[model samples]
Target: MTDYAIGDLQGCHAEFVELLERIDFAPARDRLWLAGDLVNRGPDSLACLREVRALGNAAFTILGNHDLHLLAVARGGARLNRKDTLDDILAAPDREALLDWLQSRPLLVRQAFDAGGDTVMVHAGLLPQWSADEAAGLAGEVEARLGSERSGAFLEQMYGNEPACWQASLDGIDRLRVIVNVLTRMRFIDADGCLDFSAKEGLDSAPAGFAPWFRYPRRDDLRLVFGHWAALQGRAEGARVRAEATDTGCVWGGNLTALNLDTGERIGVSSHLRR
Candidate 1:
């Protein structure tokens, strides 16, 4: 089966459908690794969520910041931003099912290959201190909370930037928040390995003493695929680790991109949104 990893959908359903057609995707024969942010900021949030959900086992998704924000808002844990286009999803008849499915998704997914390397997928980037397996374990900590009875309470506490640095002794909400941030909201990290939420632009916009997380030294046995940094336009690499970016900013008038994991080929479809 062909495995294709696509960037953040961000509610651009038409472009998503077109890209699928371009790749000649067959649900029975091909698998999809969606890099998250499946809904928000574009015109068709509900449709996008529905289409992906219908794909069932054919599609595997991780939660992005926007996806989590949607859950938080629905649970009264966060407020809607002025630019958010998530109303359609929140108001849909299948909203509960969608949100439940989203919350049930893991923060990290790893696919092992017989060829001696694995592909690790996250919505954003990994911390310098985490090996892929360690990250997966930490991700499970948050996933357990999200899938438990206290999930609503956890969502309420999931919205902060405090405790920016990681520590082995961290526990409770602080620990969960750090895991969430590193997996979903991280971009650049300070010299001390603390997350810097200041910049969302390209590499040139990195704050002083901070650099893209992928640039730091890490394990080399896995390929890290991520979305969320739209300004990168599907281009990012690291000296010590292999990283691939797939977010091409479809919601911001750029093209939607998908990377073929096995063949390393990229296919894209232009956004219809006016710039």
Candidate 2:
């Protein structure tokens, strides 16, 4: 059984399907790990979500910023950007079911191997202070709220970047928002673990006294597999920590990519659909 970690779908369903076919993926045998942003800004988000959901246990996923935005928008808590192509998804007959499936996806996924190896897959980065286990627990805090009966209320408060850092003392929306940001929107962070939202450039562009989250000393705990930062493509790595980027910007006219978790092998399929 092969295990493939795919880059963000970002609504490029055709490319996703093409990549699957190129790999000759058999859902009955092979497993798939999706890094999220499964919709928006591309051609066919509905199809992407439907196809991935159809895979059932053969597929594992995490939530991305855009994916969360979709939930917010669907619940009337957020407005759609001009570039957003989610109209089709929100208008689909199965829109309720699709959004339900999406909101049900966890913010972080921990894939354990009996070989004493484990990898944490999140939409973005994890705070340096938390170990993989702590991170998963942190994620659960958000997942539980997102899947609750009042999830729409949670989405209404999902936006904002305040509290810019982690503090166990935080409660309510602030706590959940920070957790969501770190696991979905974070790219660079200061030495004190305060997230820098403005700097989205490569490593050399890190603000003074701030560095990529994966470079933090304490991050070596879990082998992290994340995808939100497309600038690094599929090879974003750190000095010692295992932070692998799978978002190759397929929606930007780039090729879709997949990385094999166990074998460290990667495969690509050129995007034939318009971004």
Q: Which ranges in model 1 have alpha carbons more than 4 Å from their true place?
A: 114-116, 237-239
User: Candidate 2: which stretches are off by over 4 Å?
Assistant: 114-116, 219-221, 273-275
Query: What clash pairs does model 2 have?
Result: none
All candidates: TM-score? 0.97, 0.95
Please give, for residues 1-275, the per-residue lDDT of candidate 2 as tens digits: 88889978999898898899988999999999999899998989899999999999999988999999999999846889999999999899999988888889998888786542788899988887888888889899998888784546778888787989889889998998899999999999887789988888677888888888887776355678889887876766574577778998899888789888887788999877654
How many backbone collisions does model 1 have? 0
Candidate 1 per-residue lDDT, tens place, 19-86, comes to: 99999999999999999899899999899989999999999899999999999999746889999998
lDDT score for residue 191 of model 1: 59
lDDT of 2: 0.86
Clash pairs for candidate 1: none
lDDT minimum window of 10 residues, candidate 2: 233-242
